[model samples]
Target: MSQGRTTEGVRDQRAELAEANHVLVDQGILDGFGHVSVRSAEDPDTFLLARNLAPGLVQPEDVQVFTLQGETDDPRKPYLERYIHSEIYRARPDVRAVVHSHSPAVIPFGVSTVPLRPILHMAGFLAPRVPVFEARDTLGSGSDLLVGTAASGAALAEVLGDAAVVLMRGHGFTSVATSIPEVVYRAVYTGVNARVQAEALRLGECTYLSDEEAAATVATNTPQIGRAWQYWRDRTA
Candidate 1:
């Protein structure tokens, strides 16, 4: 892909980024403190995100562009966890968007040994083992468990490696994808799968999708993400 985009392309991406923030909030994937960002189509070294605001309240003007090094041109401070998006973009060339959420339903699997699995077709992306990033291992025994620094962000990205999602032990989780809509899709379904898996575990054994099943479902569902995206966009609008 080219490292430059037309003015219209940039404007459209900004709107999509803003819409992603609201869609995530509307879906309950993000409450008061989560964030979403998209890599700048005009410049591979930069990405765009809302500045230190609740996802639901983000407006187009609230969006700020930041370098891959996590530096922003705006005088206002960016999100403290902005490094999560920066370092992930630095590490994963194919990833165009990232979402960091303290999704309530997904927290248990992150804090415990229970693995988040693909119990539903919509969340087939979870078939790949979701790696857990323990901040203590990278930041020391007593740390805030926040990927606040470039070093911490890089460490978390290393754990994420090629996976669609990574669980931050005791913190939350990050979802990555090739587009903002796909990342939002993964983030939403991840929470749904977590909730369903928990309920199933309480009842009895839960039969997850097999590897082949997951692959097939992903192939079938990936192209239809526009439907969900449109629904979310309309609902939020």
Candidate 2:
């Protein structure tokens, strides 16, 4: 349904998006409660997300197009947090894909002052300190911590700013990147980084990558993302 792109091209992207959902589930980045999305191939004002269903259950046919306002014409139910992806696309032109997950290792960091930083080279994308979005700060007290509304979603997007990942207090985290594979890599490594960093902290003070080192490693890792993607994609099959 995208403009300019050939039918085959659109089909290929949809297939890849479906594969990505499986890959994330295999990577343990998403279980039953999380979701992933990609910007439309031809329209920035709209994006692609699956109807409300578990990631492992999503097929290419299940993916539906939704406007930046999180509106879709399909009759199938959509994720309540679709606004999270919609508002982020509204905010970040560079981000072609987004992943929202409740990965276990990452939950503790979001509720604590302990920042999630790059603990290893592969997590270089997480350097410069990941930001946390507090729903209560913007939504007021007695509020459920979901980014379920457009205004709340917009607030979360603002907190995400230019960072690759943003943790939500008592919720989970959101990761953004230029493509599906790259975003998956970031989301997977983020939990990895969190686990390692937490373990290192128990051993005493931990060393983290400097900004310059993280920047260099990110540049080096970007080109090699396809390698990880291939491995994860194969595991899903």
- Model 2: per-residue Cα lDDT over 9-128, one tens digit each: 667778888999999998899989899999988677889898899999999999999999999999999999999999999999999999999998999999998889898999999878
Off by over 4 Å in 1: 1-5
lDDT of 1 by residue, 1-237 (tens): 443547777888889998999999999999899999999988889999999998888888889999999999899878999999999999999999999999889989999878998999998898768899999988999898889999999999999999999999888899999999899999999999999999999999999999889989999999999999999999999
TM-score of each: 0.96, 0.97
TM-score of 1: 0.96
User: lDDT of candidate 2?
Assistant: 0.92
Error of 2 at 122 (Å): 0.3
RMSD of 2: 1.6
